[model samples]
Target: MFRQTHIRLTFINSIVFIVLISILGSIIYFYTDNKLYEDVNQSLLKSVDHYQNTDGPEDSQGGKLGEGDQAPKFMGRDPRILTLIWDENGNLLAGENRGTMIFQGNEKLIRPKKYGTLEDVQVEDFSFRYVAFKTELPQVGKITVQVIRNVNSEKELLDRLLLIILIGCGVGIICAVASGYFLAGRALVPIKKSWQKQQQFVSDASHELRTPLAVIQAKTDLLFRAPQATIQEKILDVSTISKESRRLSKLVTNLLTLARSDSDQLEMKKSTFQLDELLKEILQQYEEIAMYQEKTLRLEAPEPVAFLADKERFHQLIVILLDNAIKYTKEGGDILLSCTQSHSSISLKVEDTGIGIPEKDIPKIFDRFYQSDKARTEAEGTGLGLSIAKWIIDKHHGKIKVHSIVGQGTKIEITFPKSQK
Candidate 1:
């Protein structure tokens, strides 16, 4: 599918490039053709004027002749310019043209109309520009002077230019296709990764949701088919049902929170609050659970350190960190929570002497649905807690860092900006 996408993108890019080059090439071709023709026309007009004046009769003192005078001493005509003259009686007179002999038997060529300016004409083997005009002489009747200029040079140039344009267009389209394919691949790398991630997320979410659903179904089935259960048995069954239901609820809530965050709908209610108090309050809630597990839970803070941030998200952040620390720490192990204030930021640390994560897995722990090898085999979690924690801290314009050694301990430090107000 991605290969097809790349091909389609390259094809579209080639078409656009080809169209633009064709337009530009046509404009250049026509403009150059016109300029070449204009140069030939100007040369023809100059030759006609030279013949009309220089070849005429001289004055009494042997000076130049004026207009409308017969030439006693005729000047030679330009070799590139062929002149032909004919009297009103349809007989050739005054000038002979070797080039015009190609149209000797053609009546239209012998008795052509006055076209006033140079016009394009074609012969059997050559192309020419001809102009016919009638000028009266001193003693002779009206005679037509037809000037012909060869245009084979311009034709050859235009042919070469056409070849160049075709070659350039072909080469340009080839390069466009090659470069477009490369660029499309570069552009699709990120999109392909995003698509793979989305697929993985859906599959993982389905697997996680299916576990609780299966438990709920099995427990309810067993309860409905029970053989005369006592009150306490019924109560135990109800407790099991409630536990699974709560687990399912938590899973769904996490999924929904992530979804809202993806759609940019997680509204934050920002306010100034005492970080120390909030941490203490959250730690108090987890202390009993830690004690039940026979782990030492501790909180270290100087005084009431005020900060500006979303209160509910801040609470969630501390809860996630503390809960993870408690879950991973063994019996009789220690979990420490600390908060400190610097000149420009507030820092929080959650350290636990638990089964520390492997060095290679530390970087990927924050990824959604990512579970380290040890966590995957030994622990029970939705694998979304740290992801949520990271997202919350990122939204608060903060940073989180993790340091761990396998089988030793793990320390997570989060830093947030202080309120200027």
Candidate 2:
């Protein structure tokens, strides 16, 4: 699915690039072609203007000549510009022409209707641009002067330029395809990771919900089979049902907490709270439970600091930390909670002499649904506590640090602002 989406994105990007490049290439080609043709026309105009303005004639023909004769002047100029003079009787008179005899057949070129108008004529493989006008000369009867130029050089240059433009566009399109594909893949990386995470979350949630549901169904089935039994006789089954129901409720609540967090719906509801007292109150409740599990619990709050934050969120934060410590610690292990106030901030640390997490797993412990080997095998948790705790810390503009050594212990320290501005 992601691959298909990436390909589509790349295709769209490449198409846009190709269209823009083609338009730009066309503009360049047409603009240059127009300029080149305009330049050739300017040269032809200058040659025709110079011929018409000649004062008296050189009269180099001498003698009386034909009745329709004309005296010609020899003024050699650019070899590309060709000149021709003709009489009214359609006879080729005297003119200047230097190169390329490809322009032939003077019959159609001597027409009076073609006077003063620039025109193009294709002769074999050559292109010619010429202008014709009849001028009354003192030394020669009314004769038409034809100014022509060969534009083969311009044509060749335009052809080369067009080839270059086409090649550049081709190379640009290739680059667009490669760059578009690479950028599309880069853009999808985060989305792909988010998708994988969402899949894993759903699978884990289903597995967690199924356990309590299966247990509840089994216990209810046994109760149905023993319909004749008294309430006292079915007390154990009822207790089991109650316990599983509570566990399922807790699981659902945890899932909802995570859902709210994911959707940015969890409200901080911050207020001023006594940091030390909240932890102390929480520890008092957990001390007895720790004793029951053959573990020792202790607290060390050096100063009573007033912290301004979401009191309930801080409460949940402490609960998650202590619960994580209790679940991961072995029997007879010790759990410690310490809250201290420095001049700048409030610090809270939870240390446990538990089956500690491996060094490699510490970094990923806060990822939703991520569990270390010890937690998966030896503890009962949905593996979302640390993730929620991290969220709470981030919301309160605080930082959390975790340090754990395998088979030894783990320590978690959190720093919070004394008062947010």
Candidate 3:
């Protein structure tokens, strides 16, 4: 699914970039073509203007265009300029540079019915821009003046510019496709990770819920079969049902908490509290419970430390660590809780002599529903306690570190700032 999405995103991005590049290339091509064509037109019109101002295409003595005596008068003008004239009867006249030009055209090219507007004439292999005009000179009546200029240089330049624009567009499109694909891949990384995490979370939650549900259904079947059994006679079955139901309830509650945390909806109700006193109270409550489980629980918080934090979440965090320690420790194992404070920060530690976690498993212990025991045989927890504890620590802007040696012991230390923003 993600692979398809990545390709789709890349394709969309590349298409958009291609469209923009095409528009830009077209604008450049058209603008350059217009400018160069305008320059050629201006050059052609300027030649016609000069012809008219210099005696109206006729000798000053009222002779016809291209008379033998008019040759020396235009010999020094632009060599690319070609001047030709025609009479009302369609007779052709030539100037000095007319024969020098290599263009050959029929009557329609020379005898335009109008003037002042430039037009293109392609004669064999040569390109020319020309303008024709007719006026009654002093002696020649209705004589037409044709001014033509060679524009091969401008044509070559426009063709070269078009080629360059096409090449640039091709290169730009390739780069757009490559970069679009690369950036789209980068963008999907986080989304892919989140999707996988969500799938794992749902699978683990379903597995956790299924066990208790199956037990509850079997116990319910037993109760229904013995409808006349006394409450005392069926206490053991009832107790089993109750135990599984409580476990199911706890699992649901943990799932809900984790879901809220994932969506960032878990609000922190923070307040300044005495850290040492809270630890003392928690230790006292768990003291007898640890003794019943045949383990020793102790606390070493000698000073009062006021910390700004979410008090309820802080309590839950400590309880989670303490419960995990008691569950894993064997009979006569020692569990220690300590709180130390400085002016700027407060530190808390939970140490236990338990069946220690492997070093390879320590980093992943806080992952939801992850058990250190590969076979998952211990079965003492829903495996979400440390995950929730990690969330609570993060919410309070705290740092936690785990130190454990296999077969020896495990210790978890946490440090938090005195004030939160």
Candidate 2: what lDDT? 0.80
Predicted candidate 1 versus true structure: per-residue lDDT over 116-152, tens digit per residue: 7667766656777777677776566576767777788
Residue 20 error, candidate 3, Å:
4.7
Q: What's the ranking of the predictions by lDDT, best on top?
A: 3, 2, 1
* Model 2 misplaced stretches (Cα beyond 4 Å): 20-24, 27-94, 99-124, 127-151, 171-192, 263-281, 284-288, 291-311, 338-348, 374-378, 393-400, 415-421
Q: Write the per-residue lDDT of candidate 2 for residues 207-292, one digit (tens) a residue.
A: 98999899999999999998999989999989999988998898898899989888988878878878889999999999888999
lDDT of 1 at 395: 86
Query: Candidate 3 lDDT, tens digit per residue, 237-258?
Result: 9999999999999999999999
Top-scoring candidate (lDDT):
3
Better of 1 and 2 by lDDT: 2
Give each model a TM-score. Answer: 0.73, 0.71, 0.73
Ranking of all predicted structures according to TM-score, beginning with the best and ending with the worst: 3, 1, 2
RMSD (Å) per prediction: 5.5, 5.6, 5.1
Model 3, residue 314: C-alpha shift (Å): 2.7
Task: Write out the backbone clash pairs for model 2.
Answer: none
